[model samples]
Target chain A: MSHVQGDAKKLLARVRRIGGQLGSVERAIAEGAECGAVLQQLAAVRGAVNGLIFQMMEGHLTAHVGGQDSGMPEEELAPVLAVLRSYMK
Target chain B: MSHVQGDAKKLLARVRRIGGQLGSVERAIAEGAECGAVLQQLAAVRGAVNGLIFQMMEGHLTAHVGGQDSGMPEEELAPVLAVLRSYMK
Candidate 1:
């Protein structure tokens, strides 16, 4: 598989795992687990999820956006930038 | 500002706007706006937000992770990877 697709799959898997954690946290909250403990676990889950997000975004920049010396042709950057702009909107 | 910092600030601003959009969506649902319209707007907001996230991730990979021809030295990729791993957890 292409590197981008592989990376995306890895990210999706990680996200799914985090989704499970979120569900568990929700259940914990519903069950009235100790507030502090529950909050702590929830915070960890959030951090983990955010971290994966950060990495995925970073991966996109490297693999697609082609910064200073990406070796990728300038023309290729347009479609990527176009996608980014669409997202920003 | 450093390019990385500038990009991050722009990303954060975009995210905050999306957060507002989410809040508005909640308000719309609370007030009983047409479900179809509200869901449509909510979907648009989600798409937009995800798009920005995609861009930001791409930027991080380019600026920090240093793909194939990155003028960045190998050692530089370590700390970034470390941080990414932390996030993954």
Candidate 2:
């Protein structure tokens, strides 16, 4: 149970929801759904994935940054954290 | 077809890929995948979906913030576009 595994059940649930959202998007197009509705679904999926990313990103941060116990000095850890932040969002 | 519907087949394919990525993520967790590997998959899905979001967001901009023919003046469109930009990414 590494710190990177943050509530695996929760993560799996979010992934399932994202999968369902994608399926809905497909169905929307097939049914000749209007553009506004389709676009809204896509945006919703993106928001869900972004939330999942942030959740996993937090796990990475806690493991590598390892809080007070981390042997890596601030100067070294700062750049790593900076790079991670840039990518996560 | 209104401007908001940009290549439905292409959009559907991307959605499918995102769905597949999510499925893979679920499998990884179920199989007791290592933390680093799971995180990598999460990041990959995020990138794929981000690309999809940009595509749809572009459609939204073109349709609503429509170019020269749009009646919306700069003052009105500016804030609208700005708000869209803030949300899309």
Candidate 3:
């Protein structure tokens, strides 16, 4: 069975952090915060989110496609590849 | 040794596609492509890359942190978490 997975506590914490960042962005806009400051925070949030994305991507590669010992066959690897290819398009 | 990982052929194909898209972007800019068209392509590229990132992230979680059978302990999973946390910063 493909079990439910992931570091739940950690993921939750990440969501919280991102949420706070977004909140700050909203507040900045609501309170007439400097454009530079607002943009800087937004960029930070984007970068942070991207960083998380990379980690998850790396983890996925290690688990499914690369496999622990038995490598995923070409046929099985196709969907995984298709997923990646779609993003590049 | 963390053996060389990822689907080389597939990854190569992805890079090629992304490269082509980027080239198109460059050409569009050079040829004074319409702002709307340029923005649309840029957005498409961003979305595509994000999709790839999600796949990788999902794979990593499945392989390492989730584990096929033996669940990774909290101690062992810390580094993985740290990586994730950094991204969400």
Best by lDDT: 2
Every model's DockQ, to 2 decimals? 0.13, 0.38, 0.07
Off by over 4 Å in 2: A4-6, A72-89, B3-6, B63-89
Stretches of candidate 1 off by over 4 Å are A1-4, A65-89, B1-89
Top DockQ: which candidate number? 2
lDDT per residue (tens digit) for residues B5-65 in model 1: 7777787788888888888899999899998989888887967765675565456545533
* lDDT of all predictions: 0.64, 0.74, 0.60
Docking tier of model 3: it is incorrect
lDDT of 2 by residue, A1-89 (tens): 66545577887888898889989988987666777798788778877876777677656666667577787655776676567666544
10 residues in a row with least lDDT, candidate 2 chain A: A80-89
For model 3, what share of native contacts is present?
Answer: 0.00
**Clash tally for model 2:** 0
Instruction: List model 3 lDDT by residue over B1-89, tens digit each.
Output: 11115655665676678778888999999999899999999987876665555545555444544544533433544555454344322
State iRMS for model 2. Answer: 2.3
